[model samples]
Target: MYKLGYRNNNCIGCVKGGAGYWNKIRVDFPEVFKQRCKQSRAIGARLVRDSNGNRIFLDELSPDAGKYPDEPDFQCGFMCEIISKENNL
Candidate 1:
């Protein structure tokens, strides 16, 4: 997926995926997307948020909704303090 501009190789049909991710999944992995839609709907689980922040079902997601996940910038050599690597263990 790096060649496809995806920062991380996210699992197909990940529940946390947004509409754009699902839309892309619909193209790259249609079967997975379809299965997710059916399953999520059956469980009444809305995995995407609308422009107004209302959670919506995957199948109900607009084709025009959302953008692909961003390539996260992991260049926090001196900025990230969440983990203490200063010890350089």
Candidate 2:
């Protein structure tokens, strides 16, 4: 994934990923992308929110929705926050 310009080797269709990342997955790994959409629908788990903060399912995301990063742009999430707190950051 680093070779592909991803900062982390998270699973394809990782829930932490943004629409741009998912769209990249949709192209590079069609089956995995399809599976994620199907699974999200079945489980009612939206992996991302819009600029308006509305939860959005993968299937509902547009191919043109988000910006595709030319370089990895990782943002720290809750897990990172927890780890930082544990480390007294």
lDDT top scorer:
2
**Cα lDDT tens digits for candidate 2, 55-86:** 99998888876666753466667886786689
Stretches of candidate 1 exceeding 4 Å from the true structure = 69-89
Q: What C-alpha lDDT does candidate 1 achieve relative to the native structure?
A: 0.73
Q: Which 10 residues in a row give candidate 2 its minimum summed lDDT?
A: 67-76
Candidate 2 TM-score to native: 0.70
Give the alpha-carbon lDDT of every model.
0.73, 0.79
Q: Pairing residues by index, what is the TM-score of model 1? A: 0.69
Over 26-83, each residue of candidate 1 has an lDDT whose tens digit, in order, gives 8888899899999999999999888899999988888878777651222324333333
